[model samples]
Target: MASVAINMDENSIRGDHIASSMIDSELHECVRQGNIDDFKSRVQTHSAENLVTPCGNTLLHVAVSYGSDKIIAYLTEECPSLITTQNSQKDTVLHLAAREGKDSYAIKSLVESNPSVLRMTNEKGNTPLHDAVIKGKKKLSIFLASTDPEVAYYNNKYGRSPLYLAVEKGNKKGILDDLLKSGASIPIKIEDGDALPKGKSPVHAAIERRDKDILVKIEKEKPELLRLSEKELGNSLHYASSIGFLEGVQFLLQKFQEGAYERDSEGNYPIHLACKSHSVDVVKEYLDKFPYPKEFLNNKGQNILHVAAENGKHRVVRYILAHQKSTLVKPLLNATDKDGNTPLHLAACYGQPLASFLLLLDNRVDRLIVNNKNSTPYDLAAEISRRAEEEYAKTDEMTAVERKQIDSKNSIPADEIKGKEADTNKIGGDYFGVVISLAILYFHACPKKSLFERFPVIKRPRPLRGEEMKSLLGNLLVAAVLVAGVTFAGAIQLPQLRDQRHELNSTSRNSSHENLLYGYLFLDLGALSTSLVAALMLLWATFNYPKFQIPAVVLSTAMVCLAIVMMFGAFFCSVKIALLGSHGGFLAVTIIVVAVMFFLYLASLVFPWIIPLSVNQILLQVVLHYYYYIYFFLFDYSKWWLTHKLYDLKTKFSCY
Candidate 1:
């Protein structure tokens, strides 16, 4: 039995039935094969001028996709209404044309016939321009955008405009510029009907893409574009600084300083944003131009310094300290954020050792200051310093091993040492003799019975004359002894101090020669300690005898010489140990010793008069240790475990 399907009238076909024969088999095949003459002949025979494919793809869609530009032109001219017709996916002929390489002619033909086609979108809501951009067809994209400025502004399913799509495809600077010049709104954000949540404006987009040239153009033409707000009223400057666009930031600052410090909806000024961004240049420029009031607090009673320190901008903090002519340093330094963290506290918690150091350097940096959490900067520094020491220790160990390997390969043999034994001992002897002669000369040079001492017959003028001279001579003697003792200790510790005659005799006889050199170097701790004690005693003597100010000065000079000798000896010992042992450990110990010695030297230089504020030291130590231990340890362990697990999983999966 034959089944019968109802057929609508010709009038119905003209209206709704246009799709019926329009997508007939013969026409569909003809259009797909780009048989323009056959397509026209069939259209004439069936009188289905508006024929579409079964999928609603018109003759144009098939023609464009197949690069049949001539057929597309003929069809578009014959059926102008088909120019707007979309296939099942809503992709118009223009969308298809923009996607196909040779469809530029078809696209031009469609645009020329019906300019409205430029605005048509496909099933994905992609306009011809969007498709052209996605396909990186620059010429087609430019033509579409130029056809209608709004074409450049149209967004697709992803809420990304033609400009946005162009950038995503890479090297789109030229196309983006063309779009922008063709009346694309720089401040308008591409969004869905409800508007994108904190949508990125064109300026924000440009800043993110690091398109400095476009940014400059936008700034020049629409300076106020920089003032447009994004998420939470964040302006272009906020985004620019956040992304570290130095040029964009500079331009914005220059424009804003001409007065754009108006409060945003969030009550934040550009300076606040700059501080939040921790951009040293941005902060400096703003502060330098329009100095904010010292009392000026953000909506949160937080000053600029507070923002800088919180963001861990050491240079910014230093700049603020030196430039901001406000007496608010004490308050700002001690001021606590909403979280109860003072600037110093934040710096420490954030592991900003340099910022913390600078903050503490300010005498006004509140030593007794505590954060909202009641944590002091010193508390942070202590931990940081410990971790620093640990890291240095590890590095020293590695370095020491490397050095030992090198030295082992390069060092001379015992026979070679014996050959030079005479020369070495002679040098040592000469050094010792020089020390003795210098000591004797120093002793005789004392003003005991000298010309000045003989003039003490005029004692009637001062009752303390004899005592004062005695004190001076005493201070001089102490200074001389301090110098001589330190020098003698160093000379005795020299590598060539041992007698060469004994070393040569032992080597010649092939005897079980005692390593007297090693014993002298290591076991003579008594003499070294005694000399150090004598130096300290002399320093103390100079400190006590204020009346003998001149002699005290001389004694202090001796102490200086002692310190120099000690420093040199310590350095040589450290180098020797580093070269002879595991380089890593040697380096670690050397760093620690050098650090301690530096502090000691500094203390000595400033002595009873100027002591380092302990609070600052404590703060630095805490920050270093906490960050290095807790933060870095967790990060490294997690990273290592994750990598290992991933590698194992890959191996297992591959085997399977």
Candidate 2:
């Protein structure tokens, strides 16, 4: 009987608790619908804290969300402590009012009731003013900013103060004015944050936007901000110059010429950054305004020309060369840096083919000058290429050896390889073994100190002279244009063929035939696109400053090769479509013919690269044993034709 009575008492308490929850839910409904009488009756029985929503939203928070003026007034008048109640996101009623309020009247009344909530930050450290500005509540933003102006200075967890938002995202100039007028200052740095402006000022933000009007206004209102510089960004001028913002560069220089003299933490001046980023206009403007500063050297002891040449800033290099008549800039053509390297030496060391080509074109540049390492530009280029080739050989040899080992292990199961015959077959198994055999045969024919040193017939790689490059690239451009024109004509006629096929037998259209048509279209389109791009790249190389000459030429070559492959594929597809309903034997014969031709063409291209690629595999083994026999084995016929044979014949016999 005692245990039964205890269970009955527990059941009764549980029933009362559920009834109280239902009543609280009903009061929340009344708050949502603005049923004032129902809310007042239900509120008489519960404490103010008990009327909160499940998400910790007080009745006042619900009222603000529903925009219920009457309930808000009643709550503020009766239970004023609910005014500061924060929800799950730590958003007070004032935060919701500022973000979702239709007008500023409710926000004004809430702030009037409790002014301290205006400065209160939510979970994201965003105050009511931040919400107002972020939500584009212009009137509310003005009121909040003017009411407690210092609140705008409080940065959110993202390190964006209200002033930064107004410049970066707010689009409203009046809001910026009000904030600035109300003592809302933009901090130069947000301490210990990883985001930008950790040391950057608001001027950096404005300059990034390229709004000259905003810059002018900031200068007028607060001139000291123009002087504030960041360690990473240097200053507003450095950021602008680095990104090649012409208008921003103009405004910053016009307003404060002294900014041009300041250097970043990396010891690079604004002009150095401008040249490195290939901002030719910015470079010209700086040189025009301040002529003497053009010769200033950076931390690397590199002048503007050295920086431009090393970075492959071809346009800037051209401009500097054009201005060589100026006494202040002429010496930069051959200026030496800390490594005793001239601009040409740095360009060659870094393998900037375009800059090196441009430097070589000028008669004033001294190519014979050597660096501290006792290497001229030509010598450095040769050495770098040789090292690169050796590295490539090592990598290829390691990969081939590793692959062979893996194949040997995986070739036969443990139970299947029980005899020596299996091991012998695995040793000379396939095409890879044949390649290795040929490589060894070739390696033994002319053993030497090294492959490169032994190859006297193969000349060192050198940059083409300017006119030579122009002529070569011009011929390539012509080939690309011809291929582009052919493919374009094919593409234009392809749709007519489809239309004719469709009209001839609409009911007999097979999905297989349609697939072939699509394949033809795809191949033709690919050929056309690659050819056009190749043409454009070659044109840019020959005509423009050729900032990316080597890459452009290499890419154009690959594109042209791909275009030829696709063109042949397209021809095969067209033949298949035209002979779709023909006899089976005839169709098979035609496809076989095309396949033979395609393979023959591919073999022509593939066979030349096979031996040279395989030689790298046996280099280490051959170089270790045969150090005395030095001779050129693989003769480079193309190199001889380009360098010696053709030129020799042209000079020796006029018509031959």
Candidate 3:
């Protein structure tokens, strides 16, 4: 009986140990699979909040890490005190949630379970807000701050508050407001030894963030904060401008009116700041309000214009020129910095031709002012202008000659004449005779020998030598003699011809035929003599002048060809008129033919270089010629076009 009883006791102890192992296995399986329902059921039945798993994560830590919002809710509802529970790393459930930035609902659930969870800090002494701010989780930060304002005011191990984190991350406005309202010290210095000193204030933080609105808020809420100076730097305005916060600049200027004129440790005013920033509007506004003394040099002895020109701010330079009367444009124009470079010298050195042009227009800009390297503005402009002139001169000469030809053609028709009958006859006959003589001279002097025949090339006379002078003088003397003879003969013969014609007409009624014959002879002799002398003078002029020789030859050749064609057409028409007995129609046709030939002759004489070719061929040639021209223009003029575009942008939009 005793042995049987001992057997039953041993069996009972083994059954209890087996039951405990089965329960632990079930909990492990539920945690592994993330089966929230199973885990919650196990926790509800067993209260496993304090239970440590294999890696030392509590049931709460595992729940937070898995982001199981429902598991979290169930555990918090059941336990109601696991909100401050820390895992292996000493991270509370809230700290873990904030660190992962994935458990907002879980965090809210835990917070609702216990509002004091906001004060819970992690192993690194970072509160829930610290993690939230670091992760840029504004929603989480707001939640924690709303739960308890002290959470927002809580500093991390590094002694940076939620406001510092917000400013560092450049978050939206409400986060800082909440922190400030929560008694976060507005003037509190970040305890990080590397941060600005104790009185540095949050305005420095805002300036570091470049947050204009927050800076404005801080300034308005605490105007004394604007006067608050950092340990090393003097004022917020100095730091703001040094960091190039244009909006911060405007705000600081308004808050601290005369204080904006204050220089930083580096002795740079807000104007210098604006110039360095290249903010034209900011510079203009500051210049308009308080004109800095012209002698008030910065540490570098650079006035505002020098700074502006060095930074390539032409608008600022113009503004300084227009507004400040005491500012000497000439002294500033040639003023060199430590590098010994005037504004014009710097502009040219930097390859800013437009800026250089503006500076050079100032008579004060010493054209001969040499830099440290002994280079002058004139040297630069001459180099640039010379390159430009060489490129332009190559293509301009031919265009000028072509335009001159067109103008000459438009002015007068060489063949038109108006006079008495004898004068008209003398003009036409003499013109024709001159044309023939020119053609004969060209054929004799520069004869076109057959292509198959070998001939010595004739050398043109050099103008500087005596050969050309002798020929020209000889021709001029012959022309003078011809003109004198013609004038004397015309003067004497005109009255005689008039008397002879009168006598012929008076005797026609009753006199003999001898008087009529003698009158006709006198008229013919006078006309012939006048035409011969005038023709000789014209020919002499054409033959002597090298300038007129080419055109004369071309015009004479075209006229000869036209005359031949007109004579043939007239003869054929005359024969037809005689057969058909239509003299009026023949006369009209003759006039039309003469007019068309005259126009063709004129065109050939005017533009002898233009070859008569097919229209398509000419168009293709023209297109090919202008294609390269257009390409060259587009390539070379691109800089000017870009400069114009930049000017338009600068004038139209203030930002540019």
Candidate 4:
């Protein structure tokens, strides 16, 4: 309801521009102070019953505002038109009486006098029905909506019908039910000049605000609105799916079949939206509750995986790949868009390493497949990586990891990330810098007048100068010493579960833990032994064995891989179930699983080059010079290739 104010002396209100056709201030005081007898006497003498304030509100409007029924009766009896006379808001006494309170007597009297006022609209284009319904004057609104044909399809300046506005209020009052059942339009259209409210629809607003009451009212009274896209170009399901409104999604789906298969103006289905919303739960809802229509492509011919992969939504991609019905597996895995790009192509083009990893792990996806541009996914990845490198090279050379770190910092809200932006600018590049530093070490181990160095024009790593070599040697020596210390500490820290045995020589306790004590002892000793051997090799190459530069570096890499594997093995063997409680046991299991995964990843990336060249695991004819001679290194030449059959080598090691 509009704000009502009474000025006894000067009848001027803020929003209501009343007229100044006044007779006496005393008569106005009679009306304002509720002196009905005095008002009657003054009006009989002065005949100010038809007089209006500056806001065009009659004395009866003031009477209604102050709940002075006697004054309203006196004024309306003198001039019956005053009952329908409007203030600046076009509000008749009937409008105010209906809205002020449950003054049904006053409302009934006014409505019986001038039934036209029930349909009269204010300046905001709201009829008395709108005011009653919107202000929670439930009984009056239902009565007006039933009797007034003008109220059936009436739209306010906001292009909202009585039904729409009632629902938009999100009130539990039966106004929505009354108006909805009173023949009001499902979705009221605008008149020639009126504009719709900013909200897309009543149901859209309800879902956007999560107003389940309004939604339930609409769903119960009119499920048609849930599936109706009308002028909004999208239904309630699209709005809910875009934000992962799972309850809304589930309700709409269970209520109607088209709700699950609904699409927006752009031809994006609910599953496509759910995928891009980054909500695995909503995606699961679509997969489990509805038909998993793998062939249902958007207008662009992109499937759910295409949407997920392009947005870096790895979890959604994983869920879709892992959870869909088996019959649809082929289409879901290999479906291509109009551009002839599969999900893998999109993942690679966007440089999502996790998405790429997940997609490649699925054997059904053809990584060698090319897009319309005649480029494979790996080619696309390399192309994007090169472009990123060049773009970053222009502005301080930010590598991908550093770029992500910077992006994460930048992605914070502007006010929250004050001095941190400039602080990041001073930090070094990430893993790429570590790689460059390692390459520098490899260069330092070479001869001063090496063939590549003799040709100064060659862009190969130049051998370190005498002073540079001294500094490099110092850093290497420090690293080697740290490695030796850590390996020795790891060896001594190995737990002996055998000493904690229940029986003197029970094999069950011993074998129950997978010979854990022996594995720990062997792994830790191997790490310690390999570390010392590599340290010796490093010292020899840094000082006098420049002639054996390539051989020493190969031996160092081989020992490093062996030492890493053995160190993990020692850590894995030490994680006994007895030492850790249930939760801790779960955590230990998780750790080992992650370690095994990372080990496999490392093997996939480095094994092609490392296994054949490793001093600890060299093969027969060509590379027998290293592995058999080094008992100090722990690696199996026989079992190295056994794991290779598990992995299909689509490319060499450096392809990554």
Candidate 5:
């Protein structure tokens, strides 16, 4: 009997809870359906505050969610206590009304009932004004801001205030204007929650977006914000200058002239950054406004010209040289940094060809100026190139080691390793092996003055300028690179090399076959080495060293010519090897064709030098000397042959 009595009491309490929940759902539904009479009737039976949804929202919150202005007004008037009630998201009725942005009547009812709710923030710390502005509801935002302007400066959990969001969203409506006029303080650090350590400001955003119109408003209303600077991005002008925002830079300069002199945390002035961006107009503007650009050096003691040259801004370099007067230009051209390096040194060390060319074009530029390291511009360029080559060699070796480690981890079979070794040995005997052998032999036997030095056609290197230098050097570099690639490909992938390797390794390895293989390897290695050296010399010429330029062109030209000759010899050798065991008639035919092609190629090279001989008188003497010099360098190697040829040529041309 006791247990039955207890169960009945538990059932009674459960019935009451269910009955109360049904009443609350009906009351909230009446609000959602905009039925004021039904909600009023339901509220008479239960306290409106006690009648709450599962999300802790009162009838007023429900009315706001459905955008029913009449029901909302009725709820605020009758159930005044429900005005400040919040939901699960901590959003008051006003917060919901502001987010809807479509119903101004509902918003005004909520604000007029309890104006303090206008500043009430949700879970994200955003006030009603923040939601209105973020929703782009211009009229609603203006109303909310006017009701309580202090909320405009209330930063949310993300540290973005209403005014910051308005400006950042590029809201051209009266919302931003009203916020500014209401005296909302511009935020100093608007955190974007990004990966960057730096935070940005509203003014920085405007400058970054290049919204000059928005900037103008901020300038007029919040003039103090123009002076604000971030830690990483610097001030408004610094940010604008870095990105080459021309209008922003100009506007900032016109509004805040002091910003041009301010440096970023990295110690770079606005003009220095402008030069880095290659903004010639901005650079000119800075120079025009500021009396002395030379004094505006960065932390590195580098001026605008130094920055421009180091960054390869050639047009800026050119513009500065051409537009500025000699009084200003001379100082800049000759100005040395803290390291004692002039602009020319920076240009050369950074390997900026066009910038180096423009700098060296100026007569006032002191080319002999040395840096703190006691190295001239030419010496620095050489050193930098040497370091680059060494670094490349190190990277190559590291890559090889990594590949070997990966292969070892994979546990390749023993037979595969033996096969790979065979391939390696074959490659060695075919290409690099021949290269090493010939390199050692030639170096050991070479005379102090190379045999080519005895020839008269190989003239001394002379300085070239302007288009002539650009054209000749560019062509030489291209040809050298192409020949190098072809020779490298030929060395590794020739089918005859594999067959030759097989024959050399087998018991039937003929001495004749060995000789032929060596001959092919010699020709291929010669072509590869000469082309590679030619490319190296051409790259050195890009440093714009005058002495190196002419010599680079001359030497690269000779090297390329020699590479072509060796390439042809290698091609013929490959064909001969391929036709080794074939009929004598086929071998004879291949030889004839290759020989004819070789002579034609030679004629093509020799004809150009001879064509200029019959042209003009002044050109005739130069052409004759150059032609014989080239001819002797290419063909006549015997010392006696060179001496007799030079004597005959000198005697014949004595009258001229």
Candidate 6:
């Protein structure tokens, strides 16, 4: 990077002489034009050979920048010294050619003429090899790296090696392979057999890029890099788990078994990170792989469940309790952290009602256990609610004071303030309602208290009429029979072509497409089996637990939607196999099935909202409302018309 060093006295004199020599515009003109005949004539006439440019670049720099191969060949053969001379930016001819990435031929001539130019660096301390990798010039990167192992060993000012740059690119075309085939040494392995550099980890760059191939290449070449942790980010597994890369996490755990339990400096295990990410699948995989330390704690003495609960991961909390054996998870429900806070305690402290409710529902939970601060889950929840109320009140007070000030200054309308207050409370009302629920639950210390036990049973609602019940049962039967018949047909009629007939059938020469047809057949049979189970559940719900009619209906509806998705997925796969013999076709079909299935599920959810509006007007006067409002019959309907007897209609609705 050092410029041509000269004494202070002759600096200006040399600058003037160089500037005068570089002013010969005609000599440099022929280089840009790439006129080999004109360049040869100019070289013979005058000493235009090595005059420096304004930026200390020779005529060779311009020719290389413009990528004129003919001019470059003539210059390299005549003025070979231009290959070694440094420009003002300290880039030699090779650096310029590699950085531009326009012509690999120009770069080759410079490297072949003066191989020592390989070591020359620019002002940024990046050699031509660094330039090649940074710009994703595969040919130049391979050439420099294969030329010398030391070339790949060089790092820039940012401590980024050439290999790091290539990995960061995440190129799909085997750029890492080319670098490895060259003499390029992997930058991760330090001397004394250490993998870390006592600085930032370059491996993290590849993880951030999500380039699994680069990671695999590094692991294959030098498996030690996979073992090393990012100084601040933990091991490779921790990094992968943090980002919810299930494939990356799975790969790391398979290759490096020790990394599963490897905690970062913060005492976070791989499960701790996966829990932090709120990825239930990864957490499940970790539990399945390494079931030990069922109640693993982090630096804060927080169990994985505690982490999930505190972070508002509702599904993760439920999964832990549901998926694992009850004996192992029973103790975790009340396990205390360093501050004597259990999972429920943290959930209460964080004002998570769903989490608090779920935990308290467990019969095994001893709600009487007090924390280090002598506060039970209920007490903590109440305290959190109070603090939140105080904060909310404080915010309101500030807003009110400002409003008073504005009113005094501008004298705005009084109605506006009232309307704005009403609008603003709608938001505060939502969170405030949560706080109230938590406070109310604190006294009972039981969330699974039945609806009749929690509140006085008003009158029981009237049952549906015979017509309505019959219609509901009829619709359920129709849907169940339709799904069952379709799936049964699919299972029996499934076929796989055995012979190869290019002209007669779609499955001609390609063996892969034939496998796809068989896969679709399996999918169709499985869907049919699930559809049969769903139909039986609907029948059980209809005949037996009529009291739990709504829940049974919702469950049956969900299963029916799932059956539709699976059946349609099989159909779409068959269509794609018949038309396009490609795996990408399956992906496109799967997307269509997902979108259609989501729309169907959405319609099921919206039906509740739409049906009530349409029924509200007509339903009140129909046969259903007559039974609902007729609480007491003072006089018989046949006798009332004959005798004109008066009766008192006391209640608007009556349930029997």
Report the number of the highest-TM-score candidate: 2
What overall lDDT goes with each candidate model? Answer: 0.58, 0.70, 0.55, 0.63, 0.71, 0.66
lDDT (tens digit, per residue) of candidate 3 on 1-656? 99999999999999775454333767766765668777766766664655665445666776777776667777777776567777666677787777677645666867886876777676777778888778876667777777776455455666565656776666564666655555333343334433223423467778888888787666555455576556445577767765667788788887887766567656666667677665666776666666543554566666666666545566566555555564644446566655455665445433443344445445555656665556454343323333443434543433567767866766754334221211211221222222222222222222234422212222332233245434544554454444445434534544543343344343442243343334434433443443344345447545576665444433433333333333333333333323232348768678667766765665444343344434333343334435533543365346655775798799789865
Q: How many backbone clashes does candidate 1 have?
A: 38
lDDT (Cα, tens digit) per residue for candidate 5, span 305-336: 98898777876898888864667666788787
Give the Cα-based TM-score of candidate 5 against the true structure.
0.56
lDDT of 2: 0.70
Tens-place lDDT per residue, model 1, 1-656, is 12222234545656665555566777667777778788778777654445666777766677777877667778777777777887788888777777774445666867888897887777787888888877877777678777777666565666666765654544463676566567555444533342222334566677787777766765665555566556544777766766566777777777654324555555556677677675667766665665544555666566777667655565578767765566634456677655565666555544454455567667776655655545455443333333454444544544567767867886989767644422211221122222222222222222234333322222122223445545654655565565456556655655544333244433532222233334334433433454455456555654676555544444454455445545444544434333332348767777767867874765554452233335334343334444443443365435644765796699799998
lDDT of 6 by residue, 393-439 (tens): 54454556776786588675865653442121122223543453354
Q: Where does the lowest 10-residue lDDT sum fall in candidate 1?
A: 424-433
lDDT of 6 at 18: 68
* Regions more than 4 Å wrong, model 5: 1-25, 40-59, 70-92, 102-106, 112-125, 156-160, 185-199, 399-656
Which scores higher on TM-score, 2 or 6? 2
TM, every model: 0.48, 0.57, 0.41, 0.51, 0.56, 0.53
- What 10-residue stretch in candidate 5 is worst by lDDT? 422-431
- Go through the candidates in order and give the clash count of each: 38, 0, 0, 10, 1, 0
Which 10-residue window of candidate 3 scores lowest in summed lDDT? 419-428
Residue 10, candidate 6: Cα error in Å is 16
Assess candidate 3 and give its lDDT: 0.55
The 10-residue segment with the lowest total lDDT in model 2: 421-430
Clashing pairs in 2: none
Worst 10 residues of 6 by lDDT: 421-430
Give per-residue CA lDDT, model 4, range 1-656, as digits (tens): 13343353235452233333564577668777889888877677544545777677677887887777777766666778787678887888777776775464655676777787776778887777777777888777777777764364566777666666777776647677776666544444445432233324667767877777677877776666676553443777777888888888878787765765666766788788888888888888887765556756887788888888766687787777776476655677777787777887666565444455567768777767777778665445434544454555534444468787887766767545533321211221232322222222122222234433322231223455455555555555565566668768866554445545443344665475546677777877887788678778867877785556546655665676667667766766676524433356667778778877876765554454554333322122113223222321233222333433333364354478
Q: Put the candidates in lDDT order, highest first.
A: 5, 2, 6, 4, 1, 3
Each prediction's RMSD to truth: 25.5, 21.2, 26.0, 16.4, 20.1, 26.3
